[model samples]
Target chain A: MLAIETKQLSKSFWKNKVVDNIDLQVEKGEILGFLGRNGAGKSTFINMLTGIIQPSSGSYALLGVQGPNDSIKKKIGVMPDYSSLYGSMTAINHLHYLADVSGKPVSRQHCMEVLKLVGLEEHANKKAGKFSFGMKKKLAIAQAIIHDPQLIFLDEPTSGLDAESVIHIHLLIQQLHQQGKTIFMTSHNLDEVEKICSRIAIMKDGRIKKSGTMDELRAYYQSTITVTIKHSPIRPADLSTMQQWLEQAGTQLDIKENHFTIQVESEQKIAEIIRALGTYKIDIYRVDVEEPSLEEIFLEE
Target chain B: MLAICKREFIQSFKGIKSIIIIAIFLLTAYYSADFSDLLLSLSDDFTSEEKQIIHTVGISFLIMFLGMLFVMGLSHDIVNREMHERTIRFLVTRTSRTSIIVGKFLGIALFWFVCLLTSFVIISIFVHRFDLITLFQSASLAIYYSAFTVLLSVLIPKPSITMFLSIVIGIAFPILNGWVSLTSNVWVSWLKYLFPFYYVEEQNYSFLVVLLLAGVMVGIALLVFRRREC
Candidate 1:
């Protein structure tokens, strides 16, 4: 079953629409990264899905449940876009209370295990009021998954964190994914999303502008493929043959010392040039195909 | 619902509000019992049941005069505080909004029950007998205030605004109630019907109306809270 589905979902404040008419779906056991700039309606969309706020129009379903009823709530977890922790509560107490309230009470030992999963085992007894920003973020994640929810919504899980904390969070997310849990996360860090998300959706001005796998996006926006080849020095006869083949593709190769960088229309032309070079009896050292980064695709629009 | 209720109830006792409210309640119970005792000493024909009734009425008078104010003061920000802190966002996703309102009401009502029971224990120390029905009435009166506090917290969108209105109503309600009996105007006298003094007589049935009012307020609060955006 689909983990999350929305059809023509929209939310408007007064005259301004925050989440425009949008259709989106996330499959079970997939980590879908929601990407957008600031004020891009990412959080608002999540708020509607999690029942924090009702949608202005349209409808949604979570795990085959049409509404945010008890079954749906018990099946999913969320870390909201704001500070959702109680200041006076300890990390363990927060988990314990939330678990009980969700009607899926876990053991204290299990709560400790969840704390350990997020690298917060040492601070289990520490009050959340005294935690650092990174620690608070970790605690927030722990609470979201404490009930063993099948679908988890993490809003900016690692927006502001040290490199170490970011890595820790990334690993925890991956671990959760490994357990067959569907994760829907929103992040401003494009590189992190690129590194972690199995699928991605980009939002802009309250609408989804682009969404696909990295390779799919790269292939769509990538107009020219740049190939770098390191080979033996070439003779004039071999050079002319290479030049003729490169010119046929409307681009020429850049030769510096022992390496050549050439732009071609597709991967087929790269294979043709490699075969041509081999026919000339040149020792081919290496060939590299540069795929566009998520940053590049995100900024292209 | 029970889980949220348990948390709220436990949290109430963690700070000084419980201690302070209980201490003052014990003192009030002591004074009320002492005054009733002095009156009893002046008379010899009154039966034991009559003595218990007098002592209960004396204690109930002070409790009724201050119960609404105490509950409103303690619980004025109950819902709005969660909204202000954004913790309600976490709760809304885990449970239904109706349960949150009802859970909070149960918590506050339970706290009031404990406070009333303690004061009754103090009053019993002097009278040599416990008044179970009076404790029930005082506890129900406090629960009535608790219901209104929940409604106010849900109706006002901001914590500051709710707190302000709770204080205004808490102070004003008792004062107006004091004048409700003395005034000759029909409009002013109508409010006495809302007062516990108008209902808590041995044979009066109007006390049930207070409970019915509490039920209606809670029902309205549940409806309002469900539509609120966390």
Candidate 2:
């Protein structure tokens, strides 16, 4: 079953579309990366889904419960981009207060566990006002997941963290995924999305430009193979000779300086290129082929 | 809701505005000794017929100052400080919006009740030579006036606005009431009844009016907060 689903959801502020018509779905326990550049309606979409703001049109459901349902709210968690903690309260006080309001039977030990998970155990008794930005972010994370919510919406979770903290947050997210928690996180960090997300949707101008698993997206958009040859300086005319041979063998070529970059329809043509280059007594230095990154695909779209 | 109420009550002092209000109240109250002789000398000019009026007006000034403090502390804690700190989002997520608004209103009201009761106790000790009956009457009146002022605090968005309106009503209504009493003008007399200060003059009927007004204000605050966007 899908943990979250939206159909034709749209949101506007003062008749200006902040989030245009959008359709989205995330299955149970799936880590779906919501990728977009800044102001690409990523945060706006998440805000609507979490009921932080009402949508201008369309409908959505959380765990089969429709929008604005109180029961659905209990099953979902949200960590907004900003820290919304009371500055005067100690970290433990904030968590305890939230636990009480959530009506969850959380104990002191559970609070400590959450603090330890976020590596804020030592600072649990310190006022949140004195906490660093990263610590406050961790506190926000702890508050979101304290109730062990089934679905979590995390917006730019790793944006302001140090490298180590980012890795820790990624590990925490992975642990939650292992515990069968559905995570819908929005981020502009393509590398982090590539490492953590099971599937991804690339958004641009308030719409999903493309979406698929990494392998499926790669297969669909990356049909060309690029090879770099480094032996000696070769003229474009000389490279065109190689291009003609590869074209006859059913491939394309782009040459620059001493490098011969060839686009092949299939891996079977690699052997043909080697055989054709063997006839010219040209030294084949190196061959490198890579699928396009999500960044490249997003830019191309 | 109880958890949120407790949080708001305790967090009240954490706001800079609350601290400044408490500081100003304590400082002004303590230092008012400088003017006590002047106030006592003015009391000598009152005839037996006007003694009650003079005492009521003197107590009203003290209460008004305290009301200003209450308004500053409560209004900032409820509206301005919460928005400034950006903690309302976290609060709304954990508790319902109704719970937040109602809890804050009640919590600040409770804070004012405690502070007013304490201040009245001190005043009674100094003025009545530790007479228990005098202490009770003074404290009861303080509580009644505090409730009225706290209600005003809840309705107005700013402390200065509440204080300004309270002062205007407090000073103008009594003069109008006196003029109506002398001239026997029904319209002006009826207008005086609309002001909260009219109810503060006599202890018997005024207490009931104060209570009813507090209840009505609280209900309006809750209803307004229920449908509030954030």
User: Model 2 over residues A166-273: C-alpha lDDT tens digits?
Assistant: 999999999999999999998878999999999999888888888889887777676555555555555456666766676676545656666666666566777777
**Top candidate (DockQ):** 1
Q: Which ten residues in a row have the lowest lDDT in candidate 2 chain A?
A: A227-236
Task: Specify the CAPRI tier of model 2.
Answer: acceptable
> What TM-score against the true fold does each predicted structure earn?
0.90, 0.75
- CA deviation > 4 Å runs, candidate 1: A228-265, A272-287, B40-52, B180-198, B201-203
lDDT of 1 by residue, A196-301 (tens): 9999999998999988888888878766578888989888677877767766763656877677888787788889888988888888999998766787778776
Worst 10 residues of 2 chain B by lDDT: B129-138
lDDT of each: 0.85, 0.68
Error of model 2, residue B189, in angstroms: 8.5
lDDT of 1 at B151: 94
Q: How far is candidate 1 from the true structure (C-alpha RMSD, Å)?
A: 3.3
lDDT of 2 by residue, B1-230 (tens): 77766765676566676677666544444344334446558657755544433323333455543554455434433543453455555655555656666676566656655554454444444444233332233344444444444445445555556656666755553465456545666656666444344555443544456556556655666665443333
Error of 1 at B117 (Å): 1.6
RMSD of 2: 6.1
Every model's DockQ, to 2 decimals? 0.72, 0.30
